[model samples]
Target: MSTSTSADPRERILILGAAGRDFHDFNVLYRDEPRCEVVAFTATQIPDIDGRTYPPALAGPLYPHGIPIVDESGLESLIARERVDTVVLAYSDLAHTQVMHLASRVVAAGADFVVPGAHRTTLRSRRPVIAVTAVRTGVGKSQTTRHVATLVQSMGLRVVAVRHPMPYGDLAAQACQRFETPEDLVRHDCTIEEREEYEPHIDAGVVVYAGVDYGAILREAEAEADVVLWDGGNNDLPFYVPDLHIVLADPLRPGDEAAYHPGEANVRMADLVIIAKCDSATAEDIAAVEASVQALNPGAEVLRCDSPVTLDDPAAVTGRRVVVVEDGPTLTHGSMSFGAGVVGARDAGASAIVDPTPFAVGALADTYERYPNARGILPAMGYGQGQTRDLEATIRAMVDAGVVDAVVSGTPIDLTRVLTVDVPLVRARYSLREQAPGRLQAALRRALGR
Candidate 1:
């Protein structure tokens, strides 16, 4: 068979094994391609291939028009008759070999064969790194660090949450022990007390020790974790260059001088700046911050977050939950790591918190006005990393905004450590399995009444 006529713009494309998630992705890719048109779908007549019904097949009577399903015997004739120019293999892993064989045949038959780009793999022993810093203290950086850790763990990757050096607090030390894996330390039996012997910060009520050797903690954590979330203290720069720098700022801090100043050194390093305490800031205040941040870092993206937003809340999340994961120069600088407690809560069928501000609940109210039934909200607070005054203000803001919710966190500090803060705390060790996408999705679906 041969084509008697031809069109200049539309190229006939043959899609093979178009009956699964791979096909769905292809559909999305080709939906708006003006130069390529998928004309047919071909597959073998085996039980594995033929027995399964096409799940959510592409919509018909659309741009691609009707997709003719063809078998192996009919493939050559169909291609000739339809004047197909290219063949695309859309089979999943189990059927990859079959698709390859079919593509070989298509190429031999005088048609171009297109395979998707090879999956890029990084051979580095180190994992990706992401630095989590705040423009100042009390912007819920600790909480957000935990959340990112959970997210990474969900991706089937190990993670370590690192904090800047500080005066060691027993609670912080104990929290570190809880997150430390047996292999992270020289010996599994090494107690926090023994671990802190070489470092005096343990008794200072600030620094905690998670298992891995302190000298190589960052490197080891980077290698073990798919992503490492480094919690940088005020005016501290993480040792490694970050692929992405996240700066959390609390807009409600009392003095304007304490707020994020565009001229400040820290703000200049941020790839993304999130203004916390959105509920406490007036419109004028928000605008001022935005203008200042833009002036300081023209390339950086700024986001505003309020606390206590829920799935049922109609006034939350006007924007899509835009998340980007990448691997770069140093594994530690590229990805964000989430904590184990957050993962456990999501896996245990609890709603995930997504706040990063004191007035997160109020910001959520505004978000609901734009997007009703947002899946989750990022709340900001509960981890110890701010001045007493700032912490009190954050707690008060949450209360004023009616943001009451339990939170999960992990620290190198002692497990016995407890905070008498206003909100409930559910502390646990960190792990990778609890934050899986399916688990999180299911939890959100249940929360949003899906």
Candidate 2:
């Protein structure tokens, strides 16, 4: 094996067998590395080889940026002329033999051979960050975050949950302690100590910091946690970049007209598109939604779920709702919602919280317009004097509207009116309720049947 001094910073690294996603990976790895400068790309000839350009220039027209494409025929001459010292072979198993041959030839020309081991180096340096966002609020953005976080945590890995456009609060405080303001969470690497003085909150062996920007929180969590889950988006196109992204669809909301447009951009960036509220959707509606998602994200996986599945046994549901609270606003809200769901189920003799929004009844009725069982309910939104009254009103409206079987909110509202008006209220900060792991896991088990 020919060897060169590892300390040499000027070594010309020639990337071989680059194609498709592998090529993209190579570009990301050395795009800004101080020591590595990718000078050229080379590929081997196969049967009926298309004369298309290699390393397909990222920018410009035709050849683009003047990055020369070399085949096996021009390998030796190009290597010699470029004074290439190191070769980085980025090829799959099928091209391994061809890459080895090229390495041998390069080494014979008085250069060093660097075989990138088969042990997936990309996964190590390239953390797959996924941003969960919604077109608008109250569309289950926070609920989706909790569900995804639970899935990630169940995979035997650590996860950090962050709720953006909000501030971090105390998970232990009974009255919900607001520690740092939203602005403080936006700063890069803002020391944890500067904001709040509290004990650490760990979930499935992973430490979680609630209420931070999706990007900033992910960066911090990526340093320590295996995966990070963002609860909300602060602004449009929250980040210029992301590995994968998801957008939740809420059919019950009337103002969702603006959602589909932003979804166009989000779909372009997403590796998968998930359609929520599937239970209330018709076959034609599901098909339409799928087509919409596919138009933006071609070849992206689309998963649909009507509502989170409830644990079969009451004990499981009770355990998930009544115990094990996670840190963060999203989680806290999720927990409260789940607890309310459990309460609703118990009171109504129902299995789960069905249609937890006042508008859900109208939406469901419209969806099942032809069905005889279809019904509509106009819920009352009560703005009470105290927090408890507000919470009660929200829960009562939801329950009476047939949106929620049980109510969960910070304040209390009169449910007596719900019986007459067909609406029930569940009062709780939804952002905090969705953070609880038990709630998430229960919801996932209910939704995905896993």
Best by lDDT: 1
lDDT of 1 by residue, 3-65 (tens): 325855677787765233223334345545766777666654111133222222233233423
- lDDT (C-alpha) at residue 341 in model 1: 32
lDDT of each: 0.43, 0.40
Candidate 1 regions with alpha-carbon error over 4 angstroms: 1-125, 167-178, 181-214, 254-263, 309-450
Per-residue lDDT of candidate 2, residues 1-450 (tens digit): 113344556557676652322243354455446565556666541111223333223312322343433564676776777778777654332223444576689888867876443232223213444467654333455446655765776767666654442221221121112223334222322222212111112212334454312223345556766655544441123332334566665443322323433334445655555666555447677667677666656776666655442322343333121211111111121111222233323433434434333333332222224322222211122211232243344344554444343332221122332223232233222222221235434433343334
- Model 2 lDDT on a 0 to 1 scale: 0.40
Work out the TM-score per prediction.
Answer: 0.35, 0.38
lDDT of 1: 0.43
